[model samples]
Target: MASAVRDRTAGTTILDALETYLAAPKPRDPGDPSREEFLDLVHATPALRDHFMRMQRNWETTLAHAIAEESGLPDDDLQARALARFALDIGALAQESPDPAHALRTLFARLRNGWTDFPHPGP
Candidate 1:
């Protein structure tokens, strides 16, 4: 009862923070204290970590659905594509990518075109 409410509230708070970060035109640095503090708090509490993991999976699943619907990709490929997209976004954000928007656009184009390996001439 009370515990469930508390956990729900915590999940909501974290979700809101994450959404704000993702929606921002320009997010704060990856090393920001708030990000570190929240990560530390989660690390210090196993129950909280469980909630966070659930939220993360939910978020990823949502992304996967969108990708599948938009690309008409096979069900077997949805998870891999979702993970690749997730890694690209997180790496770009955490590294404070110079021209992140442009980089993302370029990479997305390659993804759509199946550029899985860099092209080069044989020796």
Candidate 2:
């Protein structure tokens, strides 16, 4: 049914795809894809790349703030807990995602709408 397909493919948000893309390991077998193939995988997915860039920028900004708050190293280290927060955010976004591809597009749309005063690059 429509609902089932939506449920199966719908939970792939920008952040989810970004993390998956980032954490993907290099192919090990000879039959596996080459480095260029892997790069193409990410490049071909423009929506995913946009999401990754946005998330990376946000994290960098957030981590910078955290660092500024701390006299020493920030508490927001790249630990499981931090990643879990990101995953949860992604899941929430995914729940509203119409499909895997639409997820990032929708996110960008929302972000752009709220930033009328500030200019942002087109996704």
Candidate 3:
């Protein structure tokens, strides 16, 4: 089941769709049939939601680890918390702003600035 979810990249696809929707100048109608069908499919399949949640968690953790490594921080709970917090803030920005790409660029710049205090790991 987990393998199936991983293969499908369902969570990423859903997230991409949501971002596209959010970025649209004129959003789709609330009663859109395709949107309704997608929601219905997710509602009818419990495993899909579970898989998405799991994939999202895994993606966050992986990103946290990468951030820790890049920042030369110990791979500890504190670093994970920092990364998670940053992600949550970015998520909020994405939801609130029509230009999510710009929000993401700002996020990456902030993250890079945050890493300036730490010594980079030598290649």
Candidate 4:
């Protein structure tokens, strides 16, 4: 993946490729090359896989921090639990929604509303 990112011949980074892939219309059937091609790219590139894993970790941490701050929860354990619950809800939403984009938007809206409704912990 590092080489793919640095490939001067391609004139594009792995991030650029990812953006292009995501921006394109999603495949409707099993024969679609987009999904397979993207997976192949990821599997072939170790750096891309590592980068994605790191991004996932960072995303979870960021979400946990945001939830903790908004809810005024000082305990690390509480933040971790909240993050786990949030992730589960997101997974469920993604599985239930036909459109991935809509699912993501709904997840954000749900999280924001939930946090807003939560009673902040006293200092």
Candidate 5:
């Protein structure tokens, strides 16, 4: 998933590559457990829960570094951006959407355009 971000040789921005990657179709097993079920299982297993947390942290770190390369945000802000992005992705997955992957692409498109369609008041 982070391959797009790490491979800059593709001549695409991190966001662009990420969006493209997200747009790719993935096969899902209908028999697989739901998100809630998966969480329940994780909570029931101490080792799994710990491992899950560690993996999430490592992914966040990878994301932070990727985002920082383009945004030039300070470390704290970069970390926050990475966390927020990850949360948004999780939220998209959690929601009952007909096209979550498309939603993700739209989000990146808006971001790549500097979100010009929306007004932003500086803090």
Candidate 6:
């Protein structure tokens, strides 16, 4: 069906954007070199990958629900926006973070707390 094709296309587009955004450099304040240095530290860490993946999944779900409620979009459309927002949210988070480590740490902490509070569903 056309709807299924549209949904697939949208999902692919969003995932591509997220891939590009994640590889981009962190934002910096004009007068602050230390901020860049801190971001470098955060970027250099190998452990942040797991944290990033978890946060991405959570953000995707959050965005889908929020957009659906706000815009009254169809489920498929909302899903597409959720995927697109994955990149946008990461960019926003990078800009807002005081330091790269802090941004990553905040995500990890949130994910940890969420898992702790809710039991995982599985057989």
Tell me, by lDDT, which candidate is best: 5
Q: By lDDT, highest first, what's the ranking?
A: 5, 3, 4, 1, 6, 2
- State the C-alpha lDDT per candidate: 0.52, 0.48, 0.55, 0.53, 0.65, 0.51
Cα misplacement distance, residue 4 of candidate 2 (Å): 40
lDDT string for model 6 (42-88, tens) is: 56876665676577666665556544543467655856564446444
**Model 5 TM-score, 2 decimals:** 0.57
lDDT of 3 at 24: 45
Candidate 1 local Cα displacement, residue 120, angstroms? 17
Q: Following a full C-alpha superposition, what root-mean-square deviation does model 3 have from the true structure?
A: 12.1
Which runs in model 6 stand beyond 4 Å of their true positions? Answer: 1-38, 74-90, 93-123
Supply the global lDDT for candidate 4: 0.53
lDDT of 4 at 53: 68
TM-score to true structure, per model: 0.46, 0.27, 0.41, 0.39, 0.57, 0.34
Candidate 4: Cα lDDT at 5: 22
Residue 114 of model 6 has an lDDT of: 43
Tell me which of candidates 2 and 6 scores higher on lDDT: 6
Kindly report which residue stretches of model 1 are placed more than 4 angstroms away from their true locations once superposed.
Answer: 1-23, 26-33, 74-76, 79-81, 88-123
Give the per-residue lDDT of model 2 (tens digit) for 14-39.
33444444333435799887645765
lDDT string for model 5 (25-97, tens) is 6677999988678988998999999998888777666676666655576655756466446644644463446
Each candidate: RMSD: 11.0, 17.3, 12.1, 13.1, 5.3, 13.1
Candidate 1's TM-score:
0.46
Where's the lowest-lDDT run of ten residues in candidate 2? 1-10
Which stretches in model 3 have alpha-carbon errors above 4 Å?
Answer: 1-44, 88-97, 101-123
